[model samples]
Target: MSDSASVDIAGLAPAVKAALLEVLIHGELPRAEIARRLNLSRASLTRITRTLVDAGLLAEGGTRLMAQTGRPSEMLILQPQARHVLGIKLTGDVLYATVTDLSATAVASRELRLPSPDPADVVAEIAGVAREFSAEYPDIVAVGIAIAGRVRQDRAGAVVEVSAFLDWTDVPLGAMVTEATGLPCSVENDVRALTVTEHWFGAGTGLDDMALITVGVGIGCGLVVNGRLVEGAHARAGQLSHLIVDDAGPYCDLGHRGCATSMLVNSAIVGAYRVAGVDYEGVVAAARAGDAVARAIFADAGRALGVLVASVANLTDPQKIVLTGDGIAVVELAGDAMRAEIARRLDTEAVDVDIDVRLWDFSEWARAGAGLAIRDMLS
Candidate 1:
């Protein structure tokens, strides 16, 4: 293959590369249309697309007839399979993975249940998975791992600041994974990784401003402002769990009474009923079966969530707010109350804001990991 076939796209200017990928993402477009949308001159567009085309990332497709002039302009196409990326989601006991082409299409996936959360043991398992995958898909260039909690990352490696789910802190996760797998690795907060996928491929796509709300074991939010994910000064910009919703509500070990986390998190709900080992799914079923107490619990939780979401809407004014995670069904069960609370709490001018609810699984979170790799490629 020619050198251009393996060009280092990371060297391109941000605007030039972004414009090219924008066209690639939106699909084959005529030169004029691409330039007009990107606010670039024909000459500038030609220069940028030329570099991409030469790098085997973009190609010229058949001409498109212009509506007004009846003239033909060649269209540009993205070579999605030019490269591949791997994504993994690391839970305390399970490791879920997926391989995706440049377009973020999953070609294969895997799941591994871990007997231990030891960093070395988990890294070894991941290396084994990467090796098995490499035999069939050699183009895989990078891997992304998503875990719950605070993560600090740089080109050299990543450190898991704290992970309550895994009971890990200050772990050099990225370096360990990279040394074992012989591939570049990125570590990101699970919810933030999901937001990355949503921004590029899911409900949040094409929007410059949006927020993703996840309600599972905990409540988390991810913000995208001006087409970029906001990590904040402390890398905790979207920590919505602590947002106080009711001063007299239940309290967690953190001692925050009536906070969204205390009122809406899985543990809070489970603790409320004092059902021995009852999972969130059971709570959903009970509420759906006309259990008044269960319904009331969900109603309160929903109201808490609604207040948290409305606070985000009022402050950020995002174009869309996406809700997902294990607690989504509970939110649905509490639909009327949730909606009413949201409508009542939101500023009158923001009442028309769009709220989207989606269901996501571990594989989807893994896909978000793949999205991190794709992000590196695009940036």
Candidate 2:
């Protein structure tokens, strides 16, 4: 991250290349503005922009008026179709995969119903998907996979450990991937990968610090700080789903009670409604219908979630908080209660960051994995 060292032509530079790349990928930045933000020089910036443009890496555009002088600025935009990356999200029963060119634009995607939970079987099937995707696109050179557990990392931030939710532990996922797909592979935690994708190109883009909370059959949290995803002590720091919010909360196999997932997940909400003797069309419908039991269930879930969000904001003071997942439907069920509790405990002044809670496509999760691979290749 220092300037004196030489930058690898293959890897993105710390400042100049990174700044330009961000503008291109995210779109619409002026030359003067890019120079000011990245502490760059206009002449040097033009040279870089020209090179990127000539290489079909960035698209250069017109100028915007600034003050009295209509200072001309080179606008940088991504050549999304220049390169390609492939990603897959592995679940117990199925896998969703996509191939994205350099700009993080999805070119082709696949959804495969898997055979067994055996890691080897899953890996082979995934390799076949990659092979097919690559054969179609021909520009793909990197592959990534997103799993749902801790990825062991060393002190230097090298990822060395992973145990996907399928009960596979200490697996050499990245290595196996490269060997099978014959491309550089980067394995990431599904949530963290999703967070990275969001931070750079999705909802969380242009924000320095943020959190993405996901709700589904399971609950997951991904944290980003100072433009880097935090992979604490073996990449398991953001495990807020297991945090106990209820002393008498329901049982979790992970040995915690009253956790966010235990009380707020899809299964939990459905189970709560079932216990109350109501059939369901999702938690959102149940709550909208004024089912007191459903309302109570979601409210409880919201309260617990509020506590979790408060903990993150209180601890990190990130610029924004993004709530997303396969189960925003449930959050919609008790939106008022969840927002109320979040407002109650959230430090409005100390944590001045805005909260952006929105629903996203499920495939975005898999694409995030591809984004990580693209990030790795670009770096």
Candidate 3:
């Protein structure tokens, strides 16, 4: 196998890149199937696959019998381990890191406590981690950083327009990381990164439209429409946290009363419990053990979340709505109320959107960074 760095992925022909992506996302497939999926002639598909194979990005694997033809056909598979990327998810206090292959499969992971949230300190930490991983995994080609922020990608690099959690504004994070580590770096909003991971490999795979709503320290939403991730004019398309849920509920930092964030976020749930020093998990456990007060708080939060989900469905009409976050247990504890609210608000009777609850894992967020790196490589 050759080094993946020898292949200029971004310089490849568009059709060849598309063919490679199809194989990467769908796994091994017969030439006829790949040609059909990509709308390529058999000759064109052969040429594309040949280029990828020569570049060590693809391989011809074991044969599969074609049911229609009663003939054995070789399958083209992605060379996932040919190269690797470092995926880092940065929060205020911790940095979750993982190394993933071309297919965005996590092979190794680690966590580091942030000594400080200063941009310089964070960049240094990221550089140190990237160097360590590159030394261990010599094929590491790029680094991707995911943070809760508004990121803008331009000719220069990815810029963090704002990251309220880290008090970062107008930070040139991508360029800094790349310069620090001697590798290409991509920066993305953590929620959008997760959405990309879902669209490419997780629950939303193969779907043209889907929504992900995360309820945790903060409420966030990511949307995919018409097979594309939606980044609005200002890169703030999915800011549904402040969407009004009730006029009489609690207030968020933005002073919005009964907004989705105010009603459904971890802090809000904990605050509503009104018990000294009790965290969100404690409240969830209490609710599970049949504590009325805890149950009521979760039920209210669940209903608010349902309203948000219904609103997303009514507006975007996604095929699925993924509800996930560290605080997602609220959905299980107050599922009945949430479903009732969703049933009441959805305008369409013929179309029932699938709501999937995924238990949160910080490693998944790191994998999202890997997904972004994969996308950057392809683009």
Candidate 4:
């Protein structure tokens, strides 16, 4: 495999980059189809593909029969192994890491305990992991860090504006990691990073509009509108946690009663069950085993989730809604109530949206970071 660092993706012309991205996301496609999708003339498409193929960023595979015509055309595919990136997901107490190729497919992963919440210490640990991965995967070209907080990116690089879990604010995390590891680096909100991965290579592929809702210790959302990820002015475009669902619901830390966070989060589910020493998974198991109280709690949470989904659909009308994270099992346990609530809120006959439930692990989040790195390189 060629070293991605030597390719200089940012130096590619806009049309060539778009052509590469087109093949990267949609897999192999005939040159005619690529030209049709990108609205490029045959000559322009040929030049773009030639440039990418010369760079080893794309390759021509076996021929495919074109539907529009009876002739066969060469299939263009991404050289996925041409580039590798290190992705890291940071939580309060642990770090998840992965090495992914150009397509954001995780090839290897590891987990490490955070020795401290201190920013300096965290940076050191991330550098250590970057070094280890670089030694094993010499093609790794960049690093992407995903955290649960607000992030701001400018020419100066990315900064963690606020992270409750890490208790950090205005930290130049991207530059710090770059300086520490001698590699290009970028930072993004964990949920938003995951949305990028989904949009390009996972569940939301080929969709111009979508929403990803994550249920766990908290309720987080990521939105894509008009083929672009909505990063609000403050980088909090999809902040749906505090949206009120039930006036009589529980209270979040900000004292919002009956909010999405208060009703649908893992803690809320466990608290609603009023069970001592039981975790969210335990409660889910009980519900599955025919425990009435547990089932009722899940039902309530599901209803809240339905309300949340309805609100997103009502506002953005996304083509699909992706439900994921560690707490996604609640969807299976209380699917009936959730679907009913959605039906009650939306015009079922007029609106058709696909809801995809994905049981993702921490390593998936790490791969999201790699996706961000790939995006940054291209941009």
Model 3, span 210-275: residue lDDT tens: 999998888889999999999999898888888898899888988888898888888888898999
Give the winner by lDDT: 1 or 4: 4
> Candidate 1: deviation at residue 32, Å?
2.1
TM-score: model 1 vs. ground truth:
0.91
On the 0 to 100 scale, the lDDT of residue 111 in model 3 is 96
Clashing pairs in 4: none
lDDT of each: 0.84, 0.73, 0.89, 0.89
Q: What is the lDDT of candidate 3?
A: 0.89
What is the TM-score of candidate 3? 0.95
Stretches off by above 4 angstroms in model 1 are 1-5, 8-16, 37-44, 66-71
What's the C-alpha lDDT at position 168 in model 1? 94
lDDT of 1 by residue, 223-243 (tens): 999999999999989878888
lDDT of 1: 0.84
lDDT tens digits by residue: candidate 4, 32-88:
898998899999998999888878889889998887898899999888887789999
**Candidate 2: tens digits of C-alpha lDDT, residues 74-105:** 56676667667888887777899988876677
Q: What is the lDDT of candidate 2?
A: 0.73
